[model samples]
Target: MTTTTPDMAPVRLYGAEHAADPERSYELLRAQGPVALAEAAPGFVVHLVTDYRAALDLLHDTETWSKDTRPWQSRVPESSSISQPTQWRPNVIFADGENHAHLRRVITDCFGLLDPHEVRTLTFRHADTLLSAFADAGTVDLVAQYATQLPLMVFNSLFGMPDEYGPRLVEMLAAMVGSDPARAGEGAQAFGAYLAGLYETKAAQRGDDLTSWFIDHPNGLDREEATQQILLTLGAGNEPTANLIANTCVRMLSDDRYFGTLTTGSLPVQHAIDDALWNDSPVANYSFHTARRDVTFHGTRIPAGAPVMISYAAANTCPHQGVPADGFRSGNKAHLAFAAGPHACPARDLALLIATAAIERLATYLPDITLAVPVEELTYKEGTIHRTLTALPARFTPLAPDADGATPWSRSSADRGSAGSPRTAPQTGAMASAP
Candidate 1:
């Protein structure tokens, strides 16, 4: 979707139906035109940037499309507030230019500075508990047992919260996942309250966790402000990480060929993780931005104050955009799973490390953990903002290492190699193999 009054190249974007399937969705829009105006919500129309170069140009040049919360408020306005939009100013995420730079710097060192030792320690700790529960059980849902536990633990420990709070955070995050941003205010309120509680406890004392960092650092937020940030992170961070790992598992189990590639690859499973982000975006759409100025994309004109959406899912999958033509190529991991340019996720490094370690270890631990469920049966909770997958049930025969692949349990033919009852999990294919 080009924003040139007539200066540069035209912008490329997709249509509405592609909201759920952005990659495919953008293709149709790009085919329709380089720039397509899309109705993302009621009385809202955004110019989709389907073309790669154009998307790159616009995302980086914040001068043109700013993330300033004052200029353009999000339809899902997740502010660091006790109440809704009118109640408070924007959070760190909404800041632009120097403001964004300064706030981002507080945690700038945190991502890269995240010690591998920490990741190793937490992964093993959570894995021990999770796998023990599934031990000897012929058919266990890996997503529930393995995939979900690791990242939440990583986030909780990193944030310095107790294990008791982890379940509550995960539960609250599930509530916000697919709810409309406007209607999700209640979730936001509950999250704010939770963060306030956390802030009060951490304010009294200090520790090495992120909460303590925020409390002590001059550049960081005060306990109350930090609490809001924590709430936002918990709500946003939990599911994306969970979905990335679970979705990867589904991708890997779907095809033996892909699984075999992972197994034998000299490189680590990082690329495979990228493939999951591009192929199946966990956060499907980031929508409903009010246009700050008069801008015309393609022939369709959008006056100032129009709602625009930057569809990262659609952008990554477009042939003309990111990733090489060969989707399976190991080097095509530069997909836009973590948004792009100015708004690129600060947690990119940490998130990737966590996902890679989780998936790599998973493929190593349970090569026989195939999907026990079908694709269509998998239900996704959808709202104007995201695509949140609820349950991924799979029946797999956790046979001995020598049991070969897809063992059929005894007693129940479907349960396989006998031990547990038949279960269901939506099969999205497995993401990690041996690579």
Candidate 2:
């Protein structure tokens, strides 16, 4: 078994190298053991669970592990970024036991009420709208021009936010998730305030949207509860969906296996999406579970209150037990991309629909699309939780606006007109140097 001597320093997850190529770091950790200790941020040491079975066991054992980070309050100063509460409010992600069930039920019920067909239709419309803005430019950054905006627009429509609110919401979420110490708190507060206003608007005029459903649900969530739940949903939905689309598109563009099948009409978009999930999940390492008490398992010791993170990317790609590096594809959805156990992502279906629709639309509209830069030149965003591209530059044959001013995939008149018109491409050359 691989082992780390005390003289060897723990792997740091904060550097540009880790962000660019975390799989390599995960491989190093997996070599140490299934459960390798690493420093996530300054002064924050976490047990990184790199084994698939071990991660599942810990995820399902809420009694032994809790999502609450309050245990670290005394140890980590309030000013420390790591000390930030996992749950800004009493929402499902950080809740436990009965509270978790109650909050999850409310959110799940709201999401369940969403018609999958409607979700797909909305996703297609948003994809078309985003693509239209850069379709005229033969060279475009897919990450900024398409992937980043589609999910945000879809969530905005689902939450019944005004068109004007979408950009601000995106800005706020970017700040909250970004590494800027000064802006993170400000972004959090601004997001909360925006949600509060949304709650008020939905209360006064309940519309046919997810926000309205939360208000009308039997759970009778208070304003604060409703706002927190919305935050959780939007926060959980946007970045992952964006990354999934960008990743899948990159695969479709760079890999001849996928591109060849696309031209032959043999491979499904879902197949590409599933492959991306197994290979490079958007949320690479997350689901932070703190030890309820001192524990030793998998030849590693973890103290009570110590943070344990599930390395989704490592576990999925783990070669142990004869699993392939690309993950097993037995036509089974066993991959932990959406996670597992009771706390698995509630919007799994919706997220898949959104991603599949976005990719399908791209393939339909830009059949000739290809990567503008070498596949090796792409860079991932700098963060621990998300594995997202900073930019995805691609070259494609620019298409003229349809006669109806709608993308070929657009099915509704409401999705027509200037929204699908060509516009100037965004500036590029911001992606990081490849490792």
- TM per candidate comes to 0.76, 0.87
Report the number of the highest-TM-score candidate.
2
Worst 10 residues of 1 by lDDT: 80-89
lDDT of 2 by residue, 180-221 (tens): 877988998898888888888999999999999998888788
Q: How high is the CA lDDT of each candidate model?
A: 0.57, 0.77
Candidate 2 local Cα displacement, residue 320, angstroms: 4.7
Q: Write the per-residue lDDT of candidate 1 for residues 1-435, one digit (tens) a residue.
A: 333232333222222343344445555556645456554444333566555555666667666565543433344234322113212234445667777776676666554556777876676556645554565575766656666666776687777778777666655554553346753556556666767776777788877788777666667575545665665465456667777877766666664445543335433466556667877766655622445677655444656755455666666666653435666645565566677786677776777677777776555444456666676565554344454455666554453322323322222345343332222321333334443
Error of 2 at 341 (Å): 0.6
How far out, in Å, is residue 146 in model 1? 4.4
